[model samples]
Target chain A: MLTNRSEVVVKKEMSLLERIYIPAILAGMRITLSHFFKRKATVNYPEVKRPFSPVYRGQHVLKRDEAGAERCTACGLCAVACPAEAITMVASERKKGEENLYREEKYASIYEINMLRCIFCGLCEDACPKEAIFLTDRIVPSTFKRGEFIYGKDKLVEKVDKRVDISKRQTQTVLEFKQNKKFAHNRLYTDKQLKEKH
Target chain B: MLAFLIYKLILVVAVFAVSLVVAMYSTYAERKIAAFLQDRLGPNRAGPFGILQPLADGVKMFMKEEIIPGTSNKWLFILGPSLAMFTACMTGVVIPWGGTLTIGDQQYPMQITDINIGILYLLGVVSIGVYGIMIGGWASNNKYSLLGAIRASSQMISYELAMGLAIIALVMHTGTLSLRDIAAMQTGWHWNIVYQPLGFLIFIVCAFAETNRAPFDLPECETELVGGYHTEYSSMKLGFYLFAEYINMFISSAVISTLYFGGYNMPFVGRFVHDPNVLAVLGSVFLFAKLFFFIFFFMWVRWTLPRFRYDQLMNLGWKILIPLALFNIALTGVLMYLGGRLH
Candidate 1:
């Protein structure tokens, strides 16, 4: 406590209006009346979704290649990088005539993300050697079962022709980050940059 | 005689149902208004715009486990909320909701009763309000409950003196105790408020105190009194107390509107409307508008002001409000005497 803090003396005298209290009450009522018409701060969740930032980390998505094949080569960088130890996958050799199913020689036979354990930090997205994993703006749906929370490949992976919605992720922060810009600008350098950075 | 009896029954039921519904919605509106004041939306889930929220709340209250504390007066505890609610709902009879509605050859008024001693009846009912709090607190067998009850009874008694004085000033000016007659006299917006502004002010302050609203909500002040008079109460018994408060507020608003704001009489509205039934309906609407506004004002003050300390509350009620009421009465008497001589 500061010793220099002066103890202010009380002023007991109140003006006629202060004694009446009606005028002061009217003034306060005016303030509250103004707020009644002002825009409400409620989001009305479920029906109306509030826009999240582009960098907003959420549900995990396993992506596909341009040729409609699994992009993950099971390099284990994402699993190793995951702080929560939420991701697990079993790798298998892509057999003959399986080029349509998998891009690389090696492919993930089983991939599961324990959503309860998963923090959605986007670390796995950054650690993916094959650019197969991403944390989309998709909110993790609440579930009653712990088993249901451990999302399998069917839940995590994008469909063959379907595209991930990244509209919210294209916010001002992404525009300022040159790397986010180069994701659309250059694929060759992005791979090289990731490899060199890793 | 049969027709009159039937009409009275209908009017009484209509008034009772309307007051209960208004009280129910007041709970919802209070929350919404409070939310808006704090820049938030309150209860928009149960139904469209949360209109069914009160129904849901009623259901919840009814479903809750009813508790009666051991070593307490069980009958008095049961009777507490019932008395509070009974006294609350009982005040609606004398209020002039609207002028007479003439159906065919018959003329029936919108009020349940046009009791000549209407104002006196209101004051009597208001006095009886103290019993509910006292009984509930006493029966609870708790110190905090007892304190709350004492606060409630004392506050009611102190404020009632000023309130009665204020009403007397108005009675002198209007020269009638019949609420309907007083309202009819203040036709075309020639309101009693213009004549007795000071009296109106005192009355409004007393209204707040009598309703046990904020600044004087010492009885149910959650922080200090725990649950106050209703501390040991649960389920519908607790609901009844809360419900009674809102009903009291509605009745007070009606009384204030009738006494000061020309009741159901609207500004220049009488000139344009001549049909008796239509006019009566419109008057009822205008009365409701005034009631709603005054109710909103009650909630507005609740959120804006802090609770008063016991000593400060006592000082204001006894020292200031009492003298102000007396002075207002003297001023009104002088004005009425002068006006009569000039005429």
Candidate 2:
């Protein structure tokens, strides 16, 4: 009973056709010849990068407002929600002439994420109420030492000329903020839309 | 007479060079075919599409250190691969590459020698190929090498009988042993294969065995015999053993096409052109086309079929192929005697 219950077993007497062996050989040759002309399965990597999906959670991005000011309010909600305790920041008050630098008067002075500890679960992005932090499609590059993986504001902040591309962002609130929210930061897309007549 | 001798010398050198070059490329072709069969890109790094790969391989072989085992007969160890390569190259001298090359006013045959007993000379050369394996294996002082050599010699000898019998059937129809005459006789669509299909089948199967190609490749079966007879050989010496096999394959393809498929004779050359030189060149091209197809088929069957067990190899050679060949000869004789002669 144990042997019978093991797995599906097939047994049959050798037919005259199988004994001759030519037909079976011809069938195998046919399969190989078919593969010869079929498209190869190898992907030529490095030169041709495969795109990630919209729902992929990757490196976190600290967003900005219309005045090119910092968005992180140093509310500590994200740090509290982090499962890995990856995010850390020092709060600072916005000075007299820093309206263009900070959207909120109270903004984060120093923000860092220990990428090695971050599980990249998008929990922090979901937990933030200020819409200052969200996950983007940029993957973390490998480093030689564990210390290099702790990304600071200089490494995490998007450059002015090359801001974070939000095409792959699938979060519903982020999408709603882009289309309806008056103060939502979308300098790249809204300017193009205004010029296009759409 | 001196001019004729000089012409023959040139023909010999040209034929030898052409055979060696073709055999070199056959290795590259074999690798490419194997890769494609499994859907992968073969060597395309050395030069454009790896055309220079064979040259690179030859250089690598020469650069490698030579090794002769301490317990081996050094002289015989050296003689083995040399003899194998020599015998393989010798078979190409009789095959008519083209009809004739006319220069100024003198007409010269493109073949190295038009020996009266051409087919007999070929069979004799092919038979000597066994000694190469035997000597190499015996001198190596390794059990695996000796076993491979024995397998090779026995396989070659057993297959040669069937091969000769198959040829005898074709000889009865043509009434000549000269390959040139046999090829000339089968001028049009009346190739010997049409008359002796069964004979061609037996001969082809035996050819596979004689050349040590797969399905019948028991001599150097890697799983059993490691590197076979050339296990102790290294550097260019090892290259000769492997290269000789490819040369044997090239010559075998040429000989097969010459005997059964009308060597140097196109289907409709006479209808289209009358210039003798032009016809000869075109005929040579046609012959090469046939040769290339046979070589590809050899590799195709190699990749397709599994190697036979040692006992199975002997059974197929003696029990099956020999009887089939004998029957073919008897049938050919009966038809020739009863009916009018077939072209």
* Best candidate, TM-score: 1
Q: After superposition, how far is residue B65 of candidate 2 from its true place, in Å?
A: 3.3
Best by lDDT: 1
> What interface RMSD does each of the candidate structures achieve?
1.0, 1.5
Query: Lowest-scoring 10 consecutive residues by lDDT in candidate 2 chain B?
Result: B37-46
* Residue B26, model 2, lDDT: 97
Q: Which stretches of candidate 2 lie over 4 Å from their true place?
A: A1-28, A44-198
Q: Report residue A102 deviation for candidate 2 (angstroms).
A: 15
TM-score of 1: 0.85
| DockQ values of all predictions | 0.58, 0.37
True contacts kept of each: 0.77, 0.43
Q: Which consecutive 10 residues in model 1 chain B have the weakest lDDT in total? A: B334-343
- In candidate 1, what are the lDDT values of residues B43-70, reduced to their tens digit? 9999998999999999999999999999
lDDT of 1: 0.89
For model 2, how does the per-residue alpha-carbon lDDT over A1-198 read when each residue is reduced to its tens digit?
A: 667568765797899899766699889878877766777655446655778888778898888765678788898888999999999999999999998888888988899999999999988876777777888877999989999999999987776666776655645777675456444455556656878967
